[model samples]
Target: MSVSKLLSRIVAHSSDRIDTCKCVASSLHDHTYGITSDPLTQFACILSALIHDADHVGVPNTQLVKEETETAKRYKGKSVAEQNSVVLSWEMLLRPEYCDLRGAIAATDAEWTRLKQLVVNSVMATDIMDKDLKGLRNVRWEKAFSEQDPSEDAHVTTNRKATIVIEHLIQASDVAHTMQHWHVYRKWNQRLFEEMYKAYKEGRSEKDPSEFWYKGETGFFDFYIIPLAKKLKDCGVFGVASDEYLTYAIQNRREWEERGEAVVDEMIEKVKAVWEEEAETTDTFVDEASVSL
Candidate 1:
């Protein structure tokens, strides 16, 4: 099968909360299909979305390398998570069970090469490994949007536009929760907090993550989420989705400023309750299993 289809199957079997693939794919559908009808571009976007977080370990790359996990060693501490996601997903796609799907997506050698490169580049762009990502994006944006003449639109190469748009689309969708309605944003935020809190408890991260969760979210919205939403609108290919996202981002930031701390406390409490419940349930299962033994 193609990587995207295989990923969809895996996600469906494994539950949706494991990653952000569905959200990114839906956002791409919202942003790209209407703008460009090219099959390859659409396929590339879908594949990138599915594989971007293919095997996330609920911890950051920094922690992965610090712990010297297998993934870190495999990628040599360079974008460990992103590289693993791409490599593992690509391997699964090439397996014999999915050969038919692979053939469907890549009928020619050149087509296969292009598809692999697009998937790799698009997935790698989401790593955010350092401060250079923003600088590189700025340069790409300038090159893509600096045209003054109406006729110049036609001169823009398909490869250039597809690559830029796919990268931006994934970036925007990766954080789409930040620009969504307050309830939606809270749901995902709490999920993320729980993930980080789990890591903190396991000694994979520094300090208790809950202490700075609210403030960190506010800073993220101010510095990254809003600018990304604006950039999506500025790209001029996504129509009003970016504007709607921007509006929600501003409103959400305001909401967070007004009462975010209280919400964080509530989220922390909720997560604690859930974890305790799970622990109790596991203990009960173990007791029963032991009795049966």
Candidate 2:
């Protein structure tokens, strides 16, 4: 019923796609990430996905930081929304009302620690827009997957690889609409467009979304979405599913490249229509109240 619960459910489905591919799984990763062979690793990832977007205000961290909102101040302008979500979800989960539920989900102290840490890590990974975090993840990817460490212990190597891979997985699942069917991608894409458009309307943004919605979508496809889909494939865990995601991403990008203009126009018009209707309803209510007075 709650947004957190719904998101968690969706993430559960997405996390199920991961599995051990060409790389052999060590004992540590056997539960989740690539292996999908262990309950602790697997369920921790699911929980991470579940609460990653909890209590989101549908605003970018940059805006919150720029506006110096309370949440931004609380987190020192870093991952404002994300840190808030983690703290909120963690508090809710630790409440006495959820005691039995927590016990069922994480029966042991070690499992509880792993689950909590992974939840934090997975949710924090969603803040990829943060420059420092993005740079760190990029470096981790290269170092973990780089061709070196011939004498490195097998478990250590696998751990590094798995760590980065799971981070990638959570990130992929975060914006997964783009990697899904075109209609699904378009649906969320338009919703995001509307959200930003409203932000500008409500004075939370500087630029109008209509001015650059098409260009932005195309650019994101070229830069962010496609590359991320490639990473999903390169991770070598999802088998044919990775290829399917890439294919869908490419198709959606192509479709947007060709027809996004008309769609953006329709989206803007729909948003305007809703605003106009609301204005009229407010005017009618005011007239009735004045007459009553």
Q: Each candidate's lDDT (Cα)?
A: 0.75, 0.77
Give one digit per residue, the lDDT tens place, for model 2 in 1-293.
12122222222233344466533334223423443555666676677777788888777999999999999999999988888988998899899999899878877898888777877777888898899989998887887766677888878877777677677777877888888888898898889987887889889999999999999889988998899889867766655666777899999999998899999999999988987998899999999999999
The worst-scoring run of ten residues by lDDT in candidate 1 lies at: 5-14
- For model 1, give the RMSD to the true fold: 9.7
Instruction: List ranges where model 2 is wrong by over 4 Å.
Output: 1-34
Residue-wise C-alpha lDDT for candidate 1, range 1-293, written one tens digit per residue: 22232222211111223348666555444344332435765688788887799889999888899999988998898888999999999999989999899888978999989889888888888886545665786677676666444555443544455567678777766777888889998898888998999988777889787889888998999888898778766665554565787899999999999989999999889888987999999999999999999
- Strongest candidate by lDDT: 2
lDDT of 1: 0.75
